[model samples]
Target: MSLETIDLSVTIGDKQILNNMTIKLERGEVLILMGPNGSGKTTLAFALLGHPKYQINKGKIILDNNDITDYPTYQRALMGLGLAFQNPVEIPGLRLSMLLNAIQMKKSGSSFDISSIDPKLIIWARNKTRELGLQPSFLEREVNVGFSGGEKKRSEMLQILTMDPKYIILDEPDSGLDVDGIKLIGETIDSLRSAGKGILIITHHAEITKFVSPDKVMIMSKGKIVDEGGIELIKKIEEYGYKDYEGVQ
Candidate 1:
């Protein structure tokens, strides 16, 4: 019933990235993984998704009771696990709607082909884009190409909505967003929670807490969890920063 990592250590190239990282993301809950830069927050996110380069030195990745530590990235995604990159890449020829249609087809187990947009698919994409404050025309543009920072984030969110994974990993979703953009993202998170989706939001700033207070907060340092508690931990980090939090468990 949870996506859990046990004694999960990861390495990239010759250097160790995560140190026995144990964590849980339960259904219908938000778990905040906060840390400073190079604290291995993103590493843990990628490791959980079974990224190829992030070799799992030891430990297990269990999702809904299935051991996925050895599963490939595509298999992990098929098992209802999804990760949103901190920096989304651009696709020059493919349209955003095309990508969304492809995800929808795969998610629903339909035959995959994108010769033309289905009318229903276009309607759905248009509605989602409008909800994100994007013009309908944005859906026709090439994926992430020539998009503003906020637009790109919204585009990523739209893809997530189409995919509709059971669990979501958002890596610094609010990083470059303005006030309005952050609020939009907060609303989207609220919707996801209401839909009973488990979320792991990896972020350095506590600003996101104002809109969506996490059920639990884990402070990560030096690639290991240093502290864990309720919302109070976020407040403490906001007040004093990670300087006093290392090795304080």
Candidate 2:
């Protein structure tokens, strides 16, 4: 599977968030997007997920060889596109298990028979929770309601792992996570990649890059990808901050 953006651009009100942004993500590969705050990392993620706020002024988004630039958000999701927001909204009154079951139904197009649901799903959720150092009871609680930063990250991972999307875009998954939380997110993402899913992560902390082992890195500045390279760039960014690159390549 693959995702490609061809000269994609977006604007809100009088500000242009993304300008001629083009990127490609292939199967079993992880791409890390790095930039300063307000460099359009989240905007790009939202655009890919077909958010209604960010209007696509020009360009096309092709996913798995299908041109879905015009598809609605739900249509894109049905086509196997998934997003983990930088600030995920809390969906009250919805149990984590129930949400996962709903995703399972959506993916398999199966009847809404909870009895027919695979028992292994529970095991899978349990294992992921343990791996993320979360409590098993989290799966029984309302989705993200009163959850801590780490717990919310775990919830996002659980949803993605269950959905098993072909192309997964994580918008700043490391935003509010600690050391352990970052490691857990990395492990979950690696697990997904091993299953043949392409991953795109938007992050600012180069420290988190150590966990994910990204195949490619893109640096966004002033509404566009100005620099791109291999993992070595991540090391360079960490050792010498991004300011060194300002006004000089």
Where is model 2 poorest over a 10-residue stretch in terms of lDDT?
Answer: 240-249
Which residue pairs in candidate 1 have backbone atoms (N, alpha carbon, C) closer than 3 angstroms, thus clashing?
none
20-62: candidate 1 lDDT, tens digit per residue: 9889999999999888889998899899888899999999999
lDDT of 1 at 176: 86
Models 1 onward score TM values of: 0.96, 0.92
Candidate 2 lands at a TM-score of 0.92
Candidate 2: segments with Cα more than 4 A from true spot: 111-119, 244-249
Number of clashes found in candidate 1? 0
* CA lDDT, candidate 1, residue 192: 96
For residue 109, model 2's alpha carbon misses the true position, in angstroms, by 1.0
Report lDDT per candidate.
Answer: 0.89, 0.85
- Name the lDDT value of residue 34 in candidate 1: 88
